[model samples]
Target: MKVLEAYDLVKVYRRRKVVDMVDLKVTEGKIVGLLGPNGAGKTT
Candidate 1:
C-alpha cells in the first residue's frame, strides 16, 4: 500500500519551473527524505 503518492507535481515561479513533471511515492512503513541545495526548491 502507498502511504503517500504524488503524480505530475509541478511548481512554477516567475516563468521558471521550480518543479516540473515530478512523481513521488512513499510506501507503507517506508521512510523518505528530500535533499536539495538552498535555492533548489526543496520546500516548494
Candidate 2:
C-alpha cells in the first residue's frame, strides 16, 4: 500500500525554480529523508 504519493510537484521562489517535476512515493512503514545545504529548499 502507498502511504503517501505525489506527482508533478513544483516549487519556485523569486522567479527561480527550486524544485521541478518532482515525484514521490512512500510505502507503508517506510522512512524517508530529504537533506540539502542551506537555502537548498530541503524544507521548502
Candidate 3:
C-alpha cells in the first residue's frame, strides 16, 4: 500500500530553512523524480 506519502516536510525562505526534515515515500508501482538546480529550491 501507500501509493504516496510525505511527512515532516518543511520549507522556509528568508529565515533560510529552504527545505528541512523532508520525507517522501512512493510505493505500489512507483516512479518518482526530483532534480534540483538553479536556486535549488526546485519549485519549493
Highest TM-score: which candidate? 2
**Which regions of candidate 3 are displaced past 4 Å?**
11-15, 20-25, 38-44
RMSD of 1: 1.4
Query: How much does each candidate deviate from the true structure in C-alpha RMSD?
Result: 1.4, 1.1, 5.2
Q: For model 3, state the Cα shift of residue 14 in Å.
A: 12
Highest-scoring model, lDDT: 2
The better candidate by TM-score, 1 or 3, is 1
Which rank order by lDDT, best down to worst? 2, 1, 3
- Candidate lDDT scores, in order, read 0.86, 0.89, 0.82
lDDT of 3 at 17: 80
| lDDT tens per residue, model 1, 1-44 | 99899999999966778888989999999988988778877776
- Tell me how candidate 3 scores on lDDT: 0.82
TM-score quality measure for candidate 3: 0.38
Relative to the unseen true structure, what is the C-alpha lDDT of residue 10 in candidate 1, on a scale of 0 to 100?
94
